[model samples]
Target chain A: MTTMPSFDQWMKAVQAEMEDALLRHLPATQQIPVRLHEAMHYAVLDGGKRVRPLLVHAAGALFDADARELQRAAAAVEMIHAYSLVHDDMPCMDDDALRRGKPTVHVQYDEACALLVGDALQSQAFDVLSSGNLPPERQLAMVRLLAQASGSLGMCGGQAIDLDSVGLQLTLEELERMHQLKTGALLRVSVLLGALAGKALNDDETAALDAYAAATGLAFQVVDDVLDATADSATLGKTAGKDAADNKPTYVSILGLEQSRALAEQLCVDAHRALQPFGEKARRLRELADLIVQRKA
Target chain B: MTTMPSFDQWMKAVQAEMEDALLRHLPATQQIPVRLHEAMHYAVLDGGKRVRPLLVHAAGALFDADARELQRAAAAVEMIHAYSLVHDDMPCMDDDALRRGKPTVHVQYDEACALLVGDALQSQAFDVLSSGNLPPERQLAMVRLLAQASGSLGMCGGQAIDLDSVGLQLTLEELERMHQLKTGALLRVSVLLGALAGKALNDDETAALDAYAAATGLAFQVVDDVLDATADSATLGKTAGKDAADNKPTYVSILGLEQSRALAEQLCVDAHRALQPFGEKARRLRELADLIVQRKA
Candidate 1:
């Protein structure tokens, strides 16, 4: 009998798969208007933890889906994540100079190019997601899902709330709602979309996976808050303490370090509990919840 | 027999239909993030001439397509157009203050809000387009078409080239190339997507419509150049002569005003010629080509 791969080994393999898919899917830098392509490449490649794509793969594997199609969906989600990061780091938004230990797109290139890069990346993500081997009906469902996750009712709406909430106190419920729309929307969709790349799941299975994803998504952000409060820039690969510095409300700010840590652990338990229905098929997702809560950075 | 509506009447009716569709399709401003929704509504409503949507309606009408589906497709295209205008008018790009005789999005709202508005609008466009009554196959095709027309190979690529070409003289070929990607792409897609909303056309009919659209799309830009050069800000509903002021290349700047006028007329003739097969069914399209050239603004 084959033993399951180590967590590190699984991560490395999925990361390589995602990297290859991204390189294959992105526009060639040699194309005309090379600067735009270059900026797009800079924004996406050799960066980030590939968390969303990994979630996509882990969830996709539950249904014994085609790896090739999962790679496409994974690449698409990563592109959307990258585009959001690029835009959020723009001068008018977060004005973050460093991301993933490199200068942000708007800092490396001009703001206009950064804006265009985000726009082009978004269009390309939908294009890639809706094409490939998925049946037309399934593809359409995926397109609608991604679109909803990315749009006003989801990420963007959450961002607007975040921007508005700066310097203002938010109740726990309000903060939860905001995070649900902002980061949670995309993370949950990543798992759902990954599963979608495979065979159809029963309603119960879909709900269980969604609950697992939703808990893990919030847990990820809660840990991010913990890291921001405890870690330094070198460890985080981005400016640490920017949340408090910007007067942005965070779990650490509201709940203090120990409580936030406790909350994150509780979320991890919830995430793992939700995956009980999937049995050992959800081992990777369970592992991800642990990693998210326990990571130092 | 019922008498066909005059050009004025047809324009008014389609404009009204598009307006109602946009209102029906856009996210209501009373939602949680009211400001973002308001900004989106402001960016889209009470704005520029509904040329693209009109093209969609005119093209879709050829095969007696469902009016409801045509409206959804038209509204989707218009949302894209509106979002582009909002971003293009941002401080990093054209930095225009006025559009359709009012402050541009970034001027009306803050730059951050404008940025989010544009991003949300784009996502919402894809969401609305891919949903609704259209078949999944047709919707997927529409999604792909819009994505291609909007991405690096199309509008954004053209805008990047335009950004780079400032203060530099470009050959007529280069100029046409930029316009083809920038303005021409969305315009052509408006016709094609509108056609796709209806019954599938024979190859000959498809080719003819494409040819007609290509000519008219270029003609629209040429006429825009003429208007930018000669019309006042009040009449044009945007800053006049800004292209020249910004040192951006235009047909009037490169080909001379008289030659540009002749080119526009020639394109209009070509547009009419391509529609010979459609006979009376092509009347609105043919008239639109004439109006595009002759409109003072």
Candidate 2:
């Protein structure tokens, strides 16, 4: 077998690719409704760790997916992530002034512009995913997966539950359900979208991928909770400890800091186990599980 | 030709169908993210003119579309319309307390809930449109059309322009472009989606439908401008004279009230002429052009 780039090298390469892909799909700053286009560009470009793109590329690697298709898929998922962050940072929501180590969209632009940026970015995501020369069924499938993941029963639902749960204690079960819907659903779909971008997988393999994504999703959130508790705002690139400050429940809130760390690690191990069916071909996926839990921010 | 429902009868039946279709696709309030679901229902159900749905069904009638397919298309468009209204009424946007004779989503619930409800409903629209047993290509077409119509170049883009244009004077050309993007694009797409719900259209027929929708869309806006200036809050169901009060440009702002009414009448004639290709089968679409321009509300 050909040698693969080290995880760091692969990640850096994919990040660069995502930058180009996202730029290509976004409306230019010079476009009509110039301010809106500028804000959309600002919200999406030159920021974020791009965890979703990394996951998409890693998963795409397993199926020998075309880089072009994966680029579109990666960009679409990242746009959704960026849009969510834009809205979540709004004064009506988290009311945060910072995101990705920069002023949040609402702080940089007005709140109305920020809202339009988020809404426009979402439409752009679907447009990018379904725009190219992919098979009709595959395109439709990807669109459906994304719509469902982003819909009421998924990310937005989680946001709603989070909104209601502020200042109130949530059980461990409730917290898990919230995270599963909010963060987990999108992450899982990122993997599935990557796979669907290339060759189809069998039932056994699909389930294995689902399991890997599910475990990894939980690990990512748990790690986020731990970081929010342990890291400073500078390191976190956002308002660290904002969850606890807002009286919002999170993995760390329910499981305690040390237990959350342990749970994240355990979840990482479970993610690795879920990749057994793919053997060595799943190395990128396996590495992601580790990175998700081990990263400082 | 078979006896058809009168315009009043046809519109009433389709409005009822849209209510059922919208409810069927929405997450039940008892669902996991109960608050979000509840807000989504509150924002969408039992409100609005259902104009987009009416346009969808009217256009579908010309194609002899399946009622089921038209139902899904109509509901999806209405969901989009509802979500836009929810966002438009937020404190950051128009900050209005009333919509469709009831408290706005943000007024009834909260700003955060309104945001989530709008977002969740947008996702639900795509989900509902893509979920059924329609042909894959047609489904993909409808999706792409909706995404394009709602994206940076479409409805949201128009909103951004409107946000930018408040208290500014716009030339007649600029005003038309703004309306075309903001409200006209969605209206045009509603017609296209309805027609797409049935059999495919040739280039000539498609062009004719596009023209028909364009004229109707503008006429609808012109009528809105007139109503906003002439009607009271109780009759309009929204705050009356909002455009004038907000200093936002409208047809009435650019043209004298007399000219605006003349424009609407001329556009209605154009709409009827565009339906010449469809002959008698285009009755519903022809009837809708009149309703849009003639409605007291």
Clashes of each: 0, 0
Model 1 fnat value? 0.75
Positional deviation of A266 in candidate 2, in angstroms? Answer: 0.7
Predicted complex 2: DockQ: 0.85
Clashing pairs in 1: none
- lDDT for each residue of candidate 1 in A247-272, tens digit (9 for 90 to 100): 99999888899999999999999999
The clash tally of candidate 1 reads 0
lDDT of 1 by residue, B192-249 (tens): 8888898766799889988998899999999999999989999999999999999899
Candidate 1: residue B121 lDDT (0-100): 91
lDDT of 2 by residue, A33-118 (tens): 99999999999999988899999998988888999999999999899889999999999999999998999999998999999999
| Per-candidate interface DockQ score | 0.84, 0.85
